[model samples]
Target: MFCPKCKSEYIEGYTHCKKCDVDLVDELPEEPDEYEDAPSIDPVKIRYAPNAIDAEMAMDLLRQNNIPCFSKHSESGGYMSIYMGFSVYGEDIYVDRNNAQAALDVLNDWDIVQGALGEDPDELEEPDSPEAPDEPDESYDNAPSYTRRRTAARVFAVYFAASIILASLFGALIMLLDILLD
Candidate 1:
């Protein structure tokens, strides 16, 4: 059987997918992914928000401005973000390469406008209570980078080249030894 959600195959005894908790099917799907037009998920971090709420606001801003953005947030205590003001691992917002420059321009303009108004977004919470200052919300949009995947093809290429060089060196060493002995 196969899990339709994850497209993972399972043996006859399994009737459901453990992770998805969905009923398995006798035959796997042959259809391609429905989100074919969606940009590839190789995300580059654009901005780091002080909290999930801010991160959400950033997402909303990007979406409203017609930029496709995503948030990388810690799953642990995610629900508590409403009550808790901060996250252990700060939230990072990402945008695809296509929309990065435009997204950065929007964020930078927001920063400049806020500075001109002498208003900190965090201070809007309450006048009586002030929290520790957070690191400036830095935007990495100009970098436009992704985490490189170490593929089997790359590993095989390195191993093949090393083995060829080793074999050639060993043969030369043996030939040199034979000549010296003679």
Candidate 2:
């Protein structure tokens, strides 16, 4: 027996495909050589997802918008995954050329909205009073830029100091070894 939907062969005892839940058939019809009646549609890449999970998410979003899409991963990814249990290579999602823009639009909307969901209602706190401040703090306007510059400078200083200390220690070790050897 074989599954008509997934086109996978099954044992004689199996009546339905576990993956597709479709009834098994004794034989599958031969594939047509050419699509003489079907309209021509070119596939266009819509997004390059960083992993299979991301690709699946994008495919789901496109499906919700009535856009058909498929994912293609690097050829080596499949081979490497056998040993590593995961593949680092990203997957590319493709859709019909006519629906490419619609697929992209749907993905863009999902990107924007996905981050704003799933907030815990019980964890949220309301202000004592819902009134706007009479005057905005002028100092707060430049706080982010100033804070960012200061933080970056501090990080650079720390790394520079650490490198200098490590170099001095290495030099001292070399001198002590030279003195002992001489």
Per-model lDDT: 0.67, 0.70
Model 2: per-residue Cα lDDT at residue 99:
84
Pairs with backbone N, CA or C atoms under 3 Å apart (clashes), candidate 2: none
Candidate 1 per-residue lDDT, tens place, 1-182, comes to: 99999999998899989899999999876888889876575556677675677778778988989988888764443533443445544577788767777887777777667767988766542211112233432444443333111232344447878999999999999999999999
TM-scores of all predicted structures: 0.42, 0.44
After superposing all C-alphas onto the true structure, candidate 2 shows an RMSD in angstroms of 15.6
TM-score of 2: 0.44
Worst 10 residues of 1 by lDDT: 125-134
Off by over 4 Å in 1: 1-33, 74-86, 120-182
Q: Taking the tens digit of each residue's C-alpha lDDT, what string does model 2 give over 91-129?
A: 767888788667767776676565468755443322111
Cα distance off (Å), candidate 2, residue 117: 2.9
The total number of steric clashes, by the backbone 3 Å criterion, in model 1 comes to 0
lDDT of 1 at 91: 74
